[model samples]
Target: MGIRTKLKRNRTQKKGMPPGSLVYIGDEQTEEVTVSAIAFDSHGMEEFEDVSIDKIKTLIDSDQVAWINVNGVHNVQLVDQISKKLGLHPLTTEDILNTDHRPKIDFFEDHLLSIVKMLDLSAESTDLDIEQVSFILMENTVVTFQEKRGDLFDPVRLQLQESKGRIRKSGADFLYYSLLDVIFDQYLIIMDEMDDRIAELEGMIMEDPDNHSLQDINQYKNTILQLKKTVWPVREVVNKLINRKVPYIKEDISFYLQDIHDHIVQANDMVETSRGQLYGLLDVYYSSLSMKMNEIMKVLTIVSTIFIPLTFIAGIYGMNFTNMPELSWDWSYPAVWIVMIIITGLMLVYFKRKNWF
Candidate 1:
């Protein structure tokens, strides 16, 4: 299913149903679920794949930190079993399936659930593609759920692979910070993409604003609106997490979270500025089209104005009055021609003086 269809389905499925219904309201994917686990401490690391839920639990029961990433959450049964095993709230499981959620953080007694929207431009069509990513932070476990596998977290994984950073030494809270850092870092990429698109539109507007410019502006405006829906609330999520004052989340990671918050604010500002640019572009597009129409109308009006008196002069001569003296005179035709030429010349001079052209 398409993203728009997923959105409609989310709304439709909720109707006539009780609140907190667990429905997988998103794009249907037949992709097999892939679970990758990595347990690492300062000493070393253990990474594996296809680990069962019970095995993950056994791994979590150990002293080392376990990072189990579950890619493809469309399998409702698997998600339910995993959530049940992790003691996740039913609403949290619903949120995991329902991927239209804004960036938010919900706290529980034993664990913390943080939900965020991941953004990407579709390579095939240049359309914005959005996905929801949920993170569960427990004592020794950090479980990440993605609707589909994405390389956005590759850098974090690479850090683990190279043993180049403190990730190997970090606890579950630090892992949470690292994963969130990766997620919010994507906003920078998204903002840059928006900037490039806005610049392209500006060039088009300045060079050749046409009917399509309005259409493109409207499309971009809608894109910005959708982006604002994701980026702005992220600021709240960042701020709340930064000031959460929870025991599970470490104070030393506060600086890193603060940096993420700053980046989120920057992303929000860019969205607002870009939205303003879009509105301004819309106005400019209308003004450009109006000027174009005015130019055409001006030329037509000038032609009609020049013909009005000429029509009247021809009409006067066209009259078939029986007693008209000029009709019988030999020079009457030439004389009428001279009079019309003079009238036309005077009218041209008047138009020139008024700068009607």
Candidate 2:
């Protein structure tokens, strides 16, 4: 879901449902579920789109590393069918169908099930687009289920197609690491974008702090929080892999998985730093507003002070009193005007020397 879209966990609908119920708990998805498979050995590679279940099974049994990518898991029947065919545990299937699942790793007897959040920053704004993705690691095959079509795995696919990297020569666990490596790299990319945004916000606050800037700062705080929540659990997932908790993940592949852990740690640190900076920005924003108010009040007070004596003089003359001696003199009015001008000039000089305005 994009940041602008309100997130809702639809598990309430499953309140009375059975424990192993196949319910979709995310945004409404109407798109058709599509499957793609990539089978490759060190010698060659083949790609299939809209592949059948039987074809996927064949590739899984072949002497190669098979990657089956299933997009759009909203269809409960289709997901149940695919899970049953692949022999995924019912609990794993339940987690896969629940898009609200946090980033976690579950070890099963035959397969290693991992859930993670895929994050992408929208191009139009700082809003983040997040989706839950699940990966099942088997002996010779790695199956990835996504909430929808499109992913950050294009580069991995390209490398596999061209046989341009060590991925082709590696096992299924290595391929799983390669896919996760893409996600970790994406985390960094999003972090870099956020860093740029923080700098931009700092500049904006310094130059012209306003309500909109405050709003943006608050929005970023929420985004950073979400990022932190997602990245931390992923760190744990990689830590488990590094500790050799999943038997299907080879030892050498575990070494590569350490890189993912390091990346997650770095990303989490960046998130923490950004969060602090945003809070600092909020303080600066309020301070700027206060200073502006002080300046405005200072100007008004000076104007009112300058007019105080003038108003008093006017008020005295405005009184209707024929008994006053100065009212009978011809030059009294001119004399009063001169006296008032002199008083105003003297007051101005005193204020200038005091530097009160």
Candidate 3:
């Protein structure tokens, strides 16, 4: 089963609910809250430690670029407070709480709202763990929300800290792009691993077809199908962002979004390729099994052929009614042995000549 079905979201809001309604969209268990802020402009950058909600407002109004990263989304009160302060719409808030949503981008009056699934492949089992991350991008500020704190944004943070690229000079839109780029890059890595696994399984199936190998191939096919469900929608989401004009997206940065769109295309292509490879694997498995069965039948037929005449000779000797001329002869036992040996040798030679063994 896909993770979406297993980790489905429960709606807490009523129908016709007003905008900005507070609802929690994560697991029931709550944990400690952690907030980190990075405020940067063309000239310099500052990292704030242990910042409170009140302190966040101070940076939101500044002309300098700012990025507010909230690690935990379990606190409804904190999430509500941030929504109220920033004047975010209720629908946007609802999406943040509804973590089961596919990747999407929505345009608001002053910001562009983007939602994406972050994937982590288990090193031990090669299974996938998916999480949802939401982004709210404005002109000078960007806010990111995740279910828990981990390495999802570590690459983006490193880029900011080292000023490795033009991240420091870029606006919040570029920061938004950076975060998405990192997430999609992870997807590529996971796809590569999946490709390797499929290739290995293909080799095993060709070498030996067994019940275990068939089961493994089916499991891999299921995994790839589930992954396709997530990736296809994401491609459409990015495509919408690239073609549609939104206030938050600058004209200059449209190309960057287009680049992300291209990555989505690449991911989709890999998914299709994986599907084809799996089908080819199934074909190979069936053919190998058929070949093995034919070999076993051939050996059984040869054994049965060699035993038929020997069984007949024994039967004739056992039916002693004194009327059997050969049984009455003085050298009958030795002659019967010689005849049996000759028959067996002839059958063996014929089988060898026919290439049946």
Q: Which is the leading candidate under lDDT? A: 2
lDDT of predicted model 1: 0.84
- Which number leads on TM-score? 2
RMSD of each: 3.5, 2.7, 2.8
Local error of candidate 1 at residue 1 (angstroms): 9.2
lDDT of 3 at 89: 80
In the range 200-236, model 2's lDDT, one tens digit per residue, is: 8999888888889988998899899989888988888
Between prediction 1 and prediction 3, the one with superior TM-score is 3
Residue ranges of candidate 3 with Cα displaced over 4 Å:
1-9, 12-21, 26-30, 325-341
For candidate 1, write residues 1-357 as lDDT tens digits. 466787797679788887657778777788898888999888888888898989878877899999999998888889999999898878889888877777788988779888898888764434788888898999899999998987588888888888877888778988888888887788888778878888888888877788787888888788889889988888888888888888778889898889999989988898889999988888877777788788789879977887888899889889998998889999999998888789888878988899977
| Residues 156-199 of candidate 3: C-alpha lDDT, one tens digit per residue | 88888888788988888899988888888887888999999989
TM-score between candidate 1 and the true structure: 0.83
TM-score of each: 0.83, 0.91, 0.89
Error of 2 at 92 (Å): 0.5
Put the candidates in lDDT order, highest first: 2, 1, 3
Cα lDDT for residue 119, candidate 2:
96
* Candidate 3: residue pairs that collide: 20-90, 25-97
